[model samples]
Each structure stands twice: as structure tokens, then as C-alpha cells.
Target: MFCVSENLYLRDVKLSDSSIVAKWKNDPLIRELSIGLDTKITNENQESDIKKSIESKQPYYIISLKDSDRPIGYIRLNWMDNSERFGWLRFGLGEERGKGYSKEALSSFLQKVFSNDTHRIDAEVYAFNKISLNLLKSLGFIHEGTRRNAYYTKGSFFDVYTLGLLKGEFNYIKRDDK
Candidate 1:
């Protein structure tokens, strides 16, 4: 079950979500930056992926516009190594890029995640993906560093830059958000 606020919503992904998910995944602009865009999704593929998330209790949810109920994206916190005290945040908003929604969607998503007592949140982005980097940085995520040639994409290996936001940072932003 997803707990959504009045302005943003997160819902348990349904099988019915496949068509849109497929469309989003296949979009060239989105695929060039996504983590799983290279893979083709069949019915079994979707079920298996969702099952894996469920089994590990990954916090996966579809994000949607509040007023129109139009699904826009999905965000998740995963690979939570107990000793690390943080989880990786990954999201792809598909063709819905540049509408000023990522910030709001992300702010709400972080609000939900940090509410659970996590120490920090981190994201590793391909250095070339300026859009994603900007979104994270605008939300106060700091540039930790980059791993040269870390990701294989678009017929080339890409450097991945890591960014992070501390719990206190999130709190400070929220407190000042008003």
C-alpha cells in the first residue's frame, strides 16, 4: 500500500500499469538514462521484477499527479545495506520531463522515505544526465564524487556521479520549505 499526500500520490504498482510502464521504459529519451531500460519486459518479466521488489520489501511506488490522477513516474529506495544506514533513490519520469514536477514529486518522495528513520539518501547518475543531476542538486543533494566510466550506456561506458542528502539536510529544507 502507498501512502500519498494531497498533492502527490504513490500507489502499489498494478499489472494494469504495464502498458504505461512499457511505454515509459521504451521512450528513447527515458531509456538513455534509466537503470533498466535496456531490458525488454514481458508479462513474466514484470511479475518477476515486482516479486523481487516485494520479497526484499523494496519501497516501490508509482507517482501520479494529484488532480488528474495521471501516472507520471515511479520512485524507489533500494539496496539498503544495513550497515550503510542509507538507501539509493532512483526515479524516471519518462516523457514528463521539464514540467517542474520532479522537484515536487521528489520532495514528497523524500518526505515519505526519511519519515522511516533512514540516515541519508544517495543517487548515482550518469554524468551526462544533466536533468537528473539538476533535480537532485536543487533538492539540496550534494555532489559527493564521480566514478569514471562506471555505467555502460548508449554504446559507451559513462561516468557515474554520486550525490547525497543527509537526514539533517532534508529536515532543514523541510523546516524552511514553508
Candidate 2:
């Protein structure tokens, strides 16, 4: 599957993209904001994951510029609860940070997700990560609540903000309906 939004696009991740993904997964800034802050990732680990996830046809994608074959980030639709028509959302970008790439990629990805079996999508963000919080909020994700002291990192605990967005709540399509 693929999603194109303006100059950005999301495509199924290839095994060749594992190295860059592993690098981002191990970045200090990325790790501190992520749930698995304590765990470390290596290329070998990423390679193994790539192989298994490919076989399982996991819903993960590489984010790239529309005309480029190189990926600058990744996103995944995970833990699909068919009974609930919900999926857990996860995304990350590398050196491509500070750009609007993520915003565009996410907007497109969510549109694609909701067009199918997904009714709602959920995201967990570290309270300290203002960038992610703002991005989700700007995209219409509601603040469900916070898991107090849910994340432990840098020798301290931090709250985790839980955010959710229903398919009906997303305005990606209507924004251009006019």
C-alpha cells in the first residue's frame, strides 16, 4: 500500500531501509522520547525484525519525498483490534526533522488508515515532547488523558499523553473538499 500527500509519500518499507531505521531508533533524542528508551537497537536487530515483519506483512512504511527513492522516516499501523476497528499509530523521522515532512506524511497515512477498516487510531507521546504533542493536536487528535509517571528516562519518570482520533474526526478529506 502507498499514500501520497503533496510532496511526501508513504510506501511499504523495504529490507534495504533497515540500516537507516536502526540508526534513527538508536538516536539519543529519539530514544528519550520513545517508549523503549531503555532498550538499544542495532542493525542486526533491525535486519531480523525486517525479515520477520515482512513475512507477517506488518503495516510499516518508509516516508520519502514524492520523487525520491530514499526514505527519511518511517510509520507503522500496528495492533489492529478488528473488533474495535482501532489501530495503534507509531512514526519517526531522522535528520529530516524540523521540516513539515512528518505532518504531511501523517495526514496522508491517517487518511489511508481510516478509508479502510480502521475507525480510530491511538498514539502515545512523552509529555516532554512538545513537537509531537503539537503535531498530533494540529492534526485533530484529541487528548484522551495522561499516564502519570509512565515513562522512565534520564533517571526520572515522565508522564505519557494518550491521544486518539476517530475516522469521522479527521478532516484530511474535507480540508480539500472545497
Candidate 3:
């Protein structure tokens, strides 16, 4: 699958993107925000995971710039329900965190997913992650509920907010190509 936004595109994740994912996974800051906070990942492990993703019929894409095919991050639809209409979203950006690429990429991905069989999309964000919380809210993701102290790390716990967006609630914004 391929989704084009102004300057970035969400394309099929390739085996070559494993190293970039491994680098991000190994970063302390990135790891702290992710579910696998305590788990250390190696390039080999990332490669194996990529292979599994390639083999599975899941929606996974690498966020890449139009000017360059190299991936700066990735987004995936995960934890799909038995009904196949709902799924959770997980994404990570390496050195391109502050850029608007993620916002565009997510918009494109959501549009693509909702245009098909998917009805609802869920995102679990740590309470301390203000950026993600703001992003989700701005994207029209309703704050459904919170799992208090759901994430434990370094002798402390953090709440996790479960944000959800239904297909009807999504507002697809087009970039003014002027």
C-alpha cells in the first residue's frame, strides 16, 4: 500500500528499513515512550520482526520523504480485533520527530484505512507524553478512557490514555497545492 501526502509518503515497509527501526528502538528516549521500554532490540531482531511483518497480512508502512526513499520512521496497524474492523496504531520517528511529516503521514494512513473495512482506530498514549496527546486530540481522536498506572518504568508508573477515532469522525484535510 502507498499513501502520498505533500512531501512524504507511507509506503510498504521493506527489509532494508529494519536497520533504521533498530536504531530508533535502541534509543533511550524512543524506548521510554514505547510499550517495549525495557526490552533492548538488536538489528537482527528488527530484521526478524520485519520478516514477520512482510509475511503477515497486516498494514505496515515506512514513512519516507518524496525526495529520498530512505525511511525516517514507520506506522502500523496492530492489535486488530476479531471482527477486523478495529485496530490500534503505533508509530515511531527517529531524528525527524519535530517535523510535520508524521502528521501528514498519519492523516494519509487514517484516510486509507477508513476508506476500507476499518471502522475504528485506537491509540494508547502515556500521560506524560504531551506531544502525542495533543497530536491525537488535534486529529479528532476522542479520549475514551484511561488505564491508570498502566505503564511501569524505573520504579514509577504512568497512566495510559486510550484515544479512539471512528471512521465518520475523521476530517480529511487536503494540502493546498498552490
Per-residue error for 164 in candidate 1, Å, reads 1.5
| Maximum-TM-score candidate | 3
Using TM-score, rank the candidates from best to worst: 3, 2, 1
Comparing 1 with 2 on TM-score, the higher-scoring candidate is 2
Q: Please, what is the TM-score per model?
A: 0.83, 0.89, 0.91
Cα lDDT tens digits for candidate 3, 1-178: 4788888888888788788889987888788887557888888999998888788767778988888876788898874776669998998888887877777788888888888889999999999888888877767799999999988988998999999999999867668421
lDDT of 1: 0.75
TM-score attained by model 3: 0.91
lDDT of 2 by residue, 68-177 (tens): 76688899876566453788888998888886888888988888878887788999999999989988888889999999998887789889999999988885733342
| Predicted candidate 1 versus true structure: per-residue lDDT over 31-66, tens digit per residue | 777654586656666666777787877777888878
Residue 156 of candidate 2: its Cα lDDT?
A: 90
Per-model clash counts, in order, read: 0, 0, 0
The whole-model lDDT of each prediction reads 0.75, 0.83, 0.83
Arranged by lDDT with the best first, the candidates are 3, 2, 1
